[model samples]
Target: MAQDEVEVLVVGAGQAGLAMSEHLGARGVPHLVLERDRIAERWRTGRWDSLVTNGPAWHDRFPGLEFADVDPDGFASREQVADYFAAYAEKIDAPIRCGVDVQRVQKNVGRPGFRVETSDGTIDARYVVAATGPFQKPAIPPVVPGNAKVVQLHSSSYGNPEQLPEGAVLVVGAGSSGVQIADELQRSGRQVYLSVGPHDRPPRRYRGRDFCWWLGVLNKWDEAAPPRGAEHVTIAVTGARGGHTVDFRALAADGITLVGMTSWFEDGRLHFASDLPVNIANGDATYLRMLDEADDYVARNGLDLPEEPEARVFGPDPECVVDPLRELDLATAGVTSIVWATGFVSDYGWLQVDAFDADGKPRHTRGVSSEPGIYFLGLPWQSRRGSSFIWGVWHDAAYVAEHIAIQRSYLAYDRAIRSSGPHLTADTSRHNQDDEPTVTTTGGSAVQVERAAGAQLGER
Candidate 1:
């Protein structure tokens, strides 16, 4: 196996990885980006053909790149997003090696830095940036005990209503994806059943502005954090007929049946949790809370924003609501398919290090890992609410790059000083050297540290 060394090794060539690469390049840092597949692999293969981002093109940007020749207010389709990243990678001439699967990433205790074992070879990197993103793996629950007669599909594999089996469809987990799929299936004239769960809801438009636009104006992305374990709010907007907010009330009016959380599948029947009405109420409350926040923000800013639309309170129709049925015989209900849109999980099985928290998530402070020389990017609320989004990753990338640059300078300086003599011990005395060297960069940033001409280098 070939052994290659680099100053930095960024895993994943999606928006996050590409952003990191651009920042590192601007700082004159020598780094390589490794992608297991083509750029934006998930966007290319995981999304439904009709899907468009909940946010508009204007908000979709990576570091040093913005969506061009696209409708600023309109959502970018899955293809458009994939193409944008690909173009950005090409435009920046990012040093990306795609089609290389990383087998494992472990600290190089024998020396310093990390040893990245890939299918192709090994990458010995001084700094390793895990830009593989938060949505690396889909979160499908363990199989609901049922006969193999029932068809199951995750949101990632779901394409359209036509792809589903003929009959009523039980769309599980009423987040944005589940609801959207249910809506589409019903619009296609199929019987759709939605299983509700705890979720945040924000109106698509409030006070004559896109919800996201208001979020930007109010600096929502800059929020220190979301509630721990909180999932991203499902922006209840759809891509059909251009784009529009999906009203569950309207869906109920249009014959879509809402049910409670799916607890299990047994005896050839699907069982639902008995908290249907409560979940619906909670979700609606969340929606109002968001609206209240927006209203408060406008008032605090002293902006003469247009008056909010007549506030019609949202609630589940009593007729459509029910004490969760203990079980529904799929055959009797004519439900033939199930679409699970529970969420995604971060899987770092290939990472052989103790960088994760008790929740199995990488423990990092604003992208700086607790473990030195390692970094995380593209995580929801990693630095702020927008960290997971394309528009938000640049900030985190810039900070990570700066840290890496500083660490590099310190290491180089230490190496030089070590080679000087026995007079300078590797203690606090090393800091007193007046003739310490500095790293000069084209980006106008300078890092200073003590230096000796021919000292042995220490791993950063």
Candidate 2:
């Protein structure tokens, strides 16, 4: 009914949004951060009881604080991480509106700002920042056939092996999440069937040192470097079991039966890979090659490194002869549950802005977008290999805040000139000319064009 004004509006008060809010607050930027639930609700509610961080504690910290004397190599439990995030918000004194769900954001007509409509009310702001993460949606593969008898649940909903139905549990998707869930099920005496797929495998540690130590030594984590093509770039796949690596041999040693990729599930029969071991071996080789390439690059770059002590490589023993599939049936194998540790997707239906690309991903360059004053942070692969990591979001958050300050300075100058009167027509004309549209080359005969328009002029 009435207009509420703010300098900036940040949607989602998770790690990304909180980081952005901290930066803005430190710079004295007047802003409000809206969260759909209490801060870090996803981590508190969505994660399983045994869920420990894949990243090391040292690397899993938010901006302005560390995990506090915890084991650097040890993984922080779900609760610990969630509490740490809560403390982070408190430490920064971030002006977060908890439990405020933003419904939509659209360009304001006849005004020099955007209008954000939330469940509570509407707020007018000069800028909007969508800090919602890629994990906004859970991706359940379409190929998974329905079985009313089989209790099905995405990895997000699964908290422990107790939640699954009684029988041999088939865990689909051999990524990090899949492997971890499979291991958990087997440990709980459930017959676990792990679906093998194309996945990256690396040692949890090399030469007795943490794998992340190697990443740092090699400078592979550097964000300032030019973009290496997708093929050359290595990312930390979030759900991978060993953090950076997958140790299938360990799973086998613990009596977990690996299965082929699930072709389809029908009539209570979960048909999966017949050649599970071979597929697992192939996947391991592919990932090892990628890691070797990264190692070579480090050596070629003459990066200094520390000598690591020897460590045992995790793999299946040559003497171990276990059937990959059908080795243990759910009913006979004492398996009571299944957990789907598949991947995630992004959803931004709440925001009414046309800032997303064709793929439905937010369009941003170093946190700045084509939509003026709208910024993004903590995105996967935003500016570097570690952009999405808890430790790395700070770098992006600071960069975005700096850009916002620059823009604010520019806006203040323009406002001052307008209030000073019409004697400076030449300056105003030059400013207007600078905002004119320009043409650029497209790939083919067509051309891509953009106006250097200012948001102060309202939607064009």
Candidate 3:
């Protein structure tokens, strides 16, 4: 087995990992980025063909990099997003090793670093940055009967309407992906059934501005993560049809059947809970809440912004609210395809450390893990509502880089004073023999760490 060593190892070459690599490079940090496939592989292979970005081009991009030839309000396609990241990787000259599958990562035995096992070889890293992004494994629930005869596909594998067989398509899960796929299928002349779920309703544009801009100025993007075990909300907005707010009433009127949460599948019949009305109500509540926040923000500053009264229709749809479908006979309805757009889950089985909570949530202060020498980046709500967004990832990577730099500087200083361990290249001018070392985080700002005085090498 080949053995290598590095100061830092970043796992995943998606937006998150590339951002980490770029920041580390800018700091002159000795690091290497490992990816199981090519850069931005998930965007190229894991997403549907017809999918577009959730945010518009201007707001959903890395800082200082514009999506050229794309309208600022327009949404980039899946291909465009993948290419954009690839181009960013190139522009930053990121040091990446692709096609390397990381098998496991554990503390180095009797050492001060981690042993990262990969298909290529073992790479000993002083610190490991798990920048795999939010999506790891497709979370598809088992709702199909054992004997059902339907072409089932998770949203990760779903391509376009033409790929499915000639029959009705039932899209379960009303998150952005599911809703967008259902809308696409229905517009392609296929009978579509959308299983609505509890989701946050966000308009594509609100008050002559993109919804992201409103969220940014309103500080919604800076919203902190909820307490552990608290329920979270999934955004149900879409960027399809250039960019538009999702109106369930309009979708119902457009001939797509709106169903409730799927309960069970038995006797070739799919049963649904009567929570359709409640879900619609909850979504409407969020919609109204967003509008009210925006309106108040505008009024508070006396800022001039147009009000689209047409966007404020809060009435429930008759088909979905009054007479929601409870049960559907798959055979009778001629439904042949099922697209499960359920959410994704992180697979940390390869990570052998105590950096996670009982619920498998990463235990981190921002991106800095409780366990030293370990960090996480690009997790949804890891630090804020925008942690997983492209620009958010860049900022998060910078924070993590600062943490790593400060830690490395302290270690180097201690080693130079004590004359122990291998030589490190980290600058240690901040850790002279004068002040005590301590670290604290000021939310949404640059990292703040006290100078080190007598801290030993390898002290976290």
Winning candidate number (lDDT):
3
* TM-scores, one per candidate: 0.87, 0.79, 0.90
lDDT of 3 at 186: 91
Local error of candidate 3 at residue 397 (angstroms): 1.1
Per-candidate alpha-carbon RMSD to the true structure: 4.9, 7.5, 4.5
Error of model 3, residue 174, in angstroms: 1.1
The pairs that clash in candidate 1 are 416-452, 417-452, 419-455
Q: Candidates' lDDT values, in order?
A: 0.78, 0.68, 0.84
Error of 3 at 268 (Å): 0.9
lDDT of 3: 0.84
Give Cα distance to truth, residue 180, candidate 1, Å.
1.5
Minimal lDDT window, size 10, model 3? 439-448
Which is better, 1 or 2, measured by lDDT? Answer: 1
Ranking by lDDT: 3, 1, 2
Best by TM-score: 3
Error of 3 at 305 (Å): 1.6
Weakest 10 consecutive residues of candidate 1 by summed lDDT:
421-430
- State the displacement of the C-alpha of residue 322, model 2, in Å, after optimal TM-score superposition: 9.0
lDDT of 2 by residue, 421-458 (tens): 43212212333534532221111111111234432322
Error of 3 at 109 (Å): 1.0
